[model samples]
Target: MKAKIHVSAAILATLCVISFFSITLLVELFGTLDQVAWIKSIIVFPGLFILIPAMAITGATGASLAKHRKGRLIQEKQKRMKIIAANGLLILIPSALVLHYWASLGQFNLAFYTVQVLELTAGFINASLMIMNANKGRKLAHK
Candidate 1:
């Protein structure tokens, strides 16, 4: 149980770090709005090095959590995650709007931004559920 907490926290922490850089890239994208040449979108290429590990660790954590717990608690955790994830989608709407409408942002290279988008998208959604589940686990642990 302690291990799970530590691991979850680590994963969430990593997610937060990823979110930070993704935002940095977004702001840079926005700043470059007027000058965002199409070919520069290729710059997103290198960032995937960070994105892939984040994804794999996140997936592995989920798999491990499920393997570690076998009962109604896991089911409850999963159910809560589903609900939070739905709300998490709402979190992205604003981002989508900013990315799509704001003239400066729209001018930026889509491919260059795609890496940031995917990182932020997955990080936000996964972190939301992971945190929620972690909190739920804490409350249950107290009982």
Candidate 2:
């Protein structure tokens, strides 16, 4: 039951991260806010909905799993998650706020673009970290 919970949460969180990254990439490729406003709305709605809940689940399940495992890999995964959480708070959250503020004001200027770029970069970094953590979890599971 614990393994299932952990794996399911991790998979869901990973999927949400990937979806967010892909949507951001598509928004960038679409070349302008005006060009992808509808798609942005689509992504934002479900992305926020799923991402937050999935992240919560992932964190809780990961903690539970780690408590049961006294292994180096689990330690590494915990360290990676801590870094990911810190990066999310420091980089991603502020970038998202700036992006939202600028977008709300209909200010798609260089500053808005800069924030968007930063947010996307942070998102990808978090996603990569999550991927590494997931891989470690898988290895631990098989052991």
TM, every model: 0.42, 0.86
Q: What is the alpha-carbon lDDT of model 2 when measured against the actual structure?
A: 0.75
lDDT of 2 by residue, 8-84 (tens): 87788788767767867887686577644544554556666766677778888789767857978988888988888
By lDDT, who's the top model here?
A: 2
* Residue-level lDDT tens digits of model 1 in 49-110: 44345444544565565775667777877686565445334543334434444433454556
Q: Give the TM-score of candidate 2.
A: 0.86
lDDT of each: 0.51, 0.75
> How many angstroms is residue 142 displaced in model 2 relative to the true structure, after the best TM-score fit?
0.9
Pairs in steric clash, model 2? none
Worst lDDT run of 10 residues, candidate 2, spans: 35-44
Candidate 2 Cα deviation (angstroms), residue 37: 3.6
